[model samples]
Target: MINRTVIVGRLVADPELRYTPNGIASCKFRVAVNRPFKNEGEQQADFISCVAWRKQAENLANFMKKGNLIGLEGRIQTGSYEGQDGKKIYTTDVVADSIQFLEPRNSTGSTQNTPNYQSSTNTGGMYQGSSQGQYGGNTQPNYSRVDEDPFANSKGPIEVSEDDLPFD
Candidate 1:
């Protein structure tokens, strides 16, 4: 069975970070995903609850805020618990395995109070790259130049003969 979800959306509110009694970090937040089609000339969006743990959680709470675009990859999780009124309370959320900040710090329209966190790449719930001790030190990935294209030096297109066709 496959259980995975990928979502790219804006945050509905600031992430709330908390720690367990054992000192493990966790964060919860909601994401607003707009529907592809318009509903009565107005776009609709779904508010999804998500949870992140450990370093990912800390990073999210410290760096992300309402209206910031983010990308996440994770699995859907559901559970139920007994309420104080003796009723069963059901909960569903995405347990994010990885998260990426889709926008630059200054582009999110955030105010001056937002933490000036340097974004870093995360994979498989693990922080990757130089986090400057905020998220622990990790080796950064070497990225190639974005302006250079490998196929830019291609010559003129060659003419193809009908004899080279596989199906005719």
Candidate 2:
């Protein structure tokens, strides 16, 4: 049985962060994902309920806000609970395994302030601004402008050590 889901959308509202009695953090939020096709010339969106736990939950609650674009990978979870009206309430949610902020805070369609997040390597969903910082390096990565060639300074063949290769 394979169960996985990926979604890119905007948050409908601010995430609600809570803690379990044992002091574990959890966050609940909704993502509004637009349908690929328009209905009657109007865009359609689905509001999906989602939950995040541990450091992921805390980071999301602290860094993100309503209307911010985000991408997440997770799996669907379903359960039922007894309601106050003596009825069974079925609940469905996407338990987020990782989340990426698609845009910078206070800006639309901008990449500034956006953290470089690698979901595969970062299960905790915490983005540390850059890979160098995350891997315990003090040096910052240099980003060249579009008109500038990154290899312009090279005049000879680049040296590559065997250890630098991904495979032997």
Candidate that would win on lDDT: 1
Backbone clashes in candidate 1 total: 0
Q: Give candidate 2's TM-score.
A: 0.68
Predicted candidate 1 versus true structure: per-residue lDDT over 59-152, tens digit per residue? 9988778888888877888989999999999999997876787777666745334333344334323333455433333433633335576767
For residues 47-159, what per-residue lDDT tens digits would candidate 2 score against the true structure?
99998877778888887888878898777888899999999999999878778877766654344565444232123322335663432222223333356778999999899
Pairs in clash, predicted candidate 2: none
Worst 10 residues of 2 by lDDT: 118-127
Task: Give the Cα-based TM-score of candidate 1 against the true structure.
Answer: 0.69
